[model samples]
Structures are given as structure tokens and as C-alpha cells.
Target: MGRILLFNKPFGVICQFSQDGLHPTLADYIPVPEFYPAGRLDTDSEGLLVLTDDGQLQHRITDPKHKLPKTYWVQVEGVPDSAALDALRAGVLLKDGMTQPAGAALIDTPPGLWPRTPPVRARKAIPTSWLELTIREGKNRQVRRMTAAVGFPTLRLIRYRIGAWTLDGLDQGTWKMNT
Candidate 1:
């Protein structure tokens, strides 16, 4: 059986195992060799990231044809109204073209989230809200762009789940192996 590593990536950590020289990368957290990230999360994002050594498994995980669902807990600058949520469900137009329809809903910041090291800046006058967004496509920075398109700029983004795997209780910088 091929190996799978579920890493709860922290903010500022790059997805690659290579040395970036400026910031921490996956190599700092995982010493296992031969595994590659199935998908990517931006350096500014946090939470679940799947890695695998099997090329076919990796392709299935990241390929749009498989339609694996990815869920994110997004902290946005403003509360999204019904229209905004509907737009997300209906697919928002983006510079790359229209995104596939995604599941979007307001949620409380997931109950046991690890606090961000530097922390998202707080604006005293503008309130931020949490959104749970699930999308099938893995477009680069899609969640951030989608939220922004609907007038709610994402202040922080944490991916909570990918397919059937989840961060669940995995702490930041830690990883769990599966076969």
C-alpha cells in the first residue's frame, strides 16, 4: 500500500519539501522522503494538506475529474448576505473564468482552532465573520478570490478537510501517516 501523510500546515509554511531559505517549508515538519503534496495550500493558509508517494493516488486527489471536495474555514472582512452565499453556490465569475458551484455557509470559527502565530489583524470598526466553503475544483487562491468577488475579503483561510480526510485533531506542524 502507498503511504499518505496528513499535515496540518501552519500559516507562512510553504508546501514544498525544499528549502525556501526565507520561511519554513514541509521539510521542517516531515522528514519522510519520496512523498509529494497531492495539492497545494498557499503560504498564507493553514490546516489539512495531504501528501502521498503514489503518483496515481496523487493525481486522483488533485484532479478535477475525481471531484474530491475540499472544505475551508474562511475568515472574511464582512458578513456575507444571502445574495453573496447564493452567488457562491451558483459559481462566481473570476478572472480565470467562472468557478464551479461551491457550498458556502457562515460558521463560527471552528471550535478548537489553533491560534495563528502573528494573528490576523483586527479592525475595530469592520467586523469579520467565518464561512465554511466547500469546493470541488482546486484552482489557485480560488477561495480568497471567490470571497473577495462577493465583497467579503478573506482575512484568514484554513482548510479543514479534503475528501474524507480531515485535520480533525491534528495539531499544526504535525502529521499523521495512513496506509
Candidate 2:
């Protein structure tokens, strides 16, 4: 069997193995050679990222046709009401087209959450809320667009789990091999 790695990527880290002159890349944290990212997370995003040495495993995880649901914990600009939740659950329209229906629910921020390095802009008038969203499709910036379409813009996006793998014990910029 080939090696598999689960990492809790921190904000500001690029998903690529090598940096293009500037900015930190996965190479700064993941030491495993010949392993490639199974999927991608934006530099501004954080949380679970998978790496694998097996090409087959890589395809299985990255291919949207396989329909492995990705779960995210999102902080948005406003409290989402039932209508907004329903809109998200029912599927929101994007520039690409209508998105697949999603599983979304209001959630409390877990205790002892580490703050983002450069925190989100504070607004005295607008409050924020956390939401858990699970989606089967992988579209570019889909989650951010979806929430905005439903009247709540995402303030922070963190992928907590992917398929059966999670970032449970992993800390920012740390990784562990799954035997």
C-alpha cells in the first residue's frame, strides 16, 4: 500500500508543493517526497488536506465524479435564517449554473478555536455566525459563492473533513502519515 498523509493546512499556505518565489507552500510543512495533493484548498482557506503517493488514490479523491462529500466549517457575515438555510440546502445558483443540493446547518463555534493570524475585518453593525456545509460537488470557490448567493458572505472557510479523513489531531502546518 502507498502512503497517505492528512494535514491541517493553515491560512496563508499554498497548496502546491513548491512556492513560486514567494509565499509559503506545502513543501514548508509536508516532508513526504513524490506525494501530491489529492485536492486543493485556496491559500486563504484552512484545514484538512490530503496527500498521497498512489496515483489511483489521488484520482479517487480529486475527481468530482466520485462524489466524495467534503465538509466545511464556514463563518459568514450574517446569521442565516431558515430561509437562507433552506436556500443553501436546496442549492443556490452560481455563475457556473445551479449547484448540487447541500447539507447545511447552523453550528456553534467550538470552544478554544484558534484565531486567524490576520483576523477578519470587524464590523460593529454586522455580526457573524458559523455554519457546517457538506457538498458532493467540487466547484471553484463554490462554497463562497453559494453563501453569498444566499445573502451571507463567507468570512472564513475551513475544511474540517474530507471523506473518511479528518484534521482531528493535526495542527496548523502539521501532517501525519496514515498507514
Find the candidate with the highest lDDT and give its number: 1
Taken over the whole model, the C-alpha lDDT of each candidate is 0.94, 0.91
For model 1, give the 10-residue run with minimal summed lDDT. 170-179
Residue pairs with backbone atoms closer than 3 Å in model 2 (clashes)? none
Q: What does candidate 2 score on TM?
A: 0.97
lDDT of 2 by residue, 85-135 (tens): 999999999988999999999999955467898898879999999999999
Best by TM-score: 1
TM-score of each: 0.97, 0.97
RMSD of each: 0.9, 1.0
Off by over 4 Å in 1: none
Give one digit per residue, the lDDT tens place, for model 1 in 69-116. 999999999889999999999999999999999999999878988899
